[model samples]
Target: MWRAGLPGGLRAVFEGSPLSSGGSPRLLEGKVALVTAGTDGIGLGVAEALGVAGAQVFLSSRRAHNVQRAVETLRGRGLQVSGVTCHVGRAEDREKMVQAALDTFGAIDILVSNAAVNPHFGPILEADESTWDKVFRVNVTAAAMLVRLVVPHMEKRGGGAIVLMSSIAGYQPMRGLGPYGVSKAALLGLVGALSPELRRSRVRVNGVAPGLVRSRFSAALWEDEAVREQALKELGADRLGAPAEVAQAVLFLVSPLASFVAGQTLVVAGGAWSRL
Candidate 1:
């Protein structure tokens, strides 16, 4: 989900997924986490963060190889972790991933919905119907559906946390990535819409909106010298945000560190002008 070149025949993400292995935090010691789009970039960082904090982590990607690599990397770090190939956009795959997490870890305590797609990068109106649908399917709809599946398990555990990934584009609306921005905007709304109700179950729902981060998936945004320079002017010469920086914000939200926080999207945009 964090890779580039979306839509049609790059990587088969939605097929029935096969489960895979190995595996936290010292805050999430007995907790279990399920993270989608977690093979690389921000997703991977979040998985690692939660694991280090003492949670058994569950990671997923559309690609089997990605899942294998991620599982190996985390296990190498001595974290309790497992993985499965999943297309978050696919209901069957989502179900399998959740079951795998439960079957492997006993119960669920944290959920991170990071799957997203940006098939079209142009004026919003110019984007085709399919483009909009694909964007919403993976970016917005899948996350909500995941909430539905995991919240019940969370309630059983007495309480849990859900962290939906958003982006700076969600607020600022990137020039050409209109469809993506809008879909992310919906996540911000999802946070607001779902939080109050989730609180009834002792579950806190929050969001993280990262700015441009250095990752293969986003290399297109700031890899160029001119664009990099412009980005630096806005975010400071230190360079674009890193996936781990964003992960820290997510860790804060999922941990007891933010027990009183819910329904709010934490912006980890460095210095970017992001707000709605």
Candidate 2:
């Protein structure tokens, strides 16, 4: 059973923190990784973990200012990193992101497709075509295209790892986030379908399904008293999850530690009942 009740002060605590805090591992010492929607929240946390794990990271966000700030924040930690402005919904931006990574690091060893959007949070039946398009465009289509762009580079390097950021809502739908939930569910199938084909090129494809994590992206879920209470009751969660916890799972997926693990979705939902 997964335990909860992590103390509030221990929110951002992880294996290696503050860069100068020392004890950084060399698990991905010579790797090059690209993370989308990496300016903050889970994406930022995942980038930090990869950087601490010794992988040179190239991250992106839709806003140029966000991209710049994220790069500065991580660089302050003494981690090797760079950034680019990429609205994953745009194909041109996606191509630019891939090109930026290659231009900076020469080759890509890992790709973490962490970009997603939820334009509407109401009932699935009420959702319009544009809303659904936006959700899938960022959450699913963009991820697949990014993977397609990075696979050749990974193939050139012999083998690589890819992680798709999914959500527990995908397995068990969230009350009002129907469109978003459906998009995340698509990611699970995306990984399963791509893993075998990519494996032939020595590329491992996997997915991470995080529960209610404490971040701006999920502020609606964790910040509201009623919502928080309901989440605690339904998920049996003692406290909201920290992004670093999810990042640890991403680090493992992209690192050599999970070399044999592929086509699977690792649930980091604090024991929440998440089964397909």
Candidate 3:
């Protein structure tokens, strides 16, 4: 006979359960994500974070070899991941990227527009027309276009999140980073313009502005000992920010926890440039 008030039956099953995993279930389970320029640096870091959180992550780069290598590396870590080659500045390529995500995961819940190029670094007035156009096309127009392409697909899934990668230079123009900085500033405006429309459709639009991040793309800024020391002096952060640090802030903005967040730019610059 069972003792009075003894935990038994379903209670016994619960008490003796091996079915429960020790860690909490992933927050992003069953979601799908697309990260542009995800073959390296900050983009790759964001992709890895989303994958670890249980999202089926789709990444893209301009080079086929990089795409293959990134896909292999992420898969090796047992993440649900895939990749394709895409030049974000091209319309056809952007369409192909969106289509690839749909084809691979059925729906996309998160879109990280992390691709940008700084072709020229000099006085803003000294920049040639071609340089200006290239900077705007890749750093601003491409990000906007990618978001436009993903909106319908995200809508199909009832709602989704979009993160645009801006830069600290957007808030404070750095010398010799003229065109690139202007383009990043434009992204901030883009986020503001898109958020109201997106929220009504249950989608969220956000931006991340990182300062002095240590990435190959920004090596010219910090690779020199003298330049690095100067940047540290100007910026409050003693050390340059890591790609992964930026990725974590981005992950939070895209996650369900940020469901109520929209039309906001979370500066991940280690208190370098605080407006308020």
Candidate 4:
């Protein structure tokens, strides 16, 4: 049920799009994808990757402007995409996001819960109860609730793919990112628990644990020259990861390429020491 091409006035975007550049591959053509926090950084990268693969992407962010920009960028690439301003922590917003996908794409086949927060940067002990609450509410709770909203849509379609945004911090506790890391660890657990049940729905649940990537979200970890150097040596990586790298990992899981792969978290970190 995919639209074949762009409408009038927008044909040039697709004509000049990377899809025509031969750099784009169409592994997910006709699939419908919903990516939360799909405005920038890893989220935007993922949106483009999925769209380039042939999925009609529905992306969202807290800000209207960001959503608009992302939608325009994707369309300019000749990808069929739309956007909604959403606060993933809100129930109303979650409902709207799901409904928008169904309304626009006709069905939902993929979900990437990539929205996350790191409100606290200090030691876990000094972190207030409110900080913990907010972290779990957005990073963990909202993700789970959003899944609940989409599972039925996926079920109706006979099956679907879901990717949660976990992190390398989940496997090894990083000093300043304790609570955030803990929440990501919870996601790893969520993938395991949800997968077994989602199998009946024919839906597959997976996650990606990325290392320190070059994004505004992780600027604190890498922006400083001295700190970046120390962190790189500690992580045993030569350079930082790019959002495109992470997006490709996501693309594989959601695509038919990763069929039979479920409940497993792909570690996208570059030698960041993540086992067990």
Q: Per-residue lDDT tens digits of candidate 1, residues 212-253?
A: 888777777788978777755754434577776677688889
True lDDT of residue 6, candidate 2: 36
Which is the leading candidate under TM-score?
2
Ranking of predictions according to TM-score: 2, 4, 3, 1
lDDT of 2 by residue, 1-276 (tens): 001223545533532254212666578999999999998889988888889879999999989999899898889888899989989889999998899999998989999999998888778899999998889989999999999999999999999999999999899878788999999999999999999999999999999999999889988887989988897677766667878778888988888889999999999988888888
- Residue 210, candidate 1: Cα error in Å is 0.1
Write one digit per residue (lDDT tens) for candidate 3, span 6-40.
23453354234321122324668889999999988
TM-score of each: 0.88, 0.93, 0.90, 0.91
Worst 10 residues of 2 by lDDT: 1-10
* Prediction RMSDs, each to the true structure: 8.5, 3.4, 10.3, 6.3
Q: What is the C-alpha lDDT of each candidate?
A: 0.84, 0.87, 0.84, 0.87
Residue 1: error of model 3 in Å? 56
Model 2 per-residue lDDT at 267: 94
lDDT of 4: 0.87
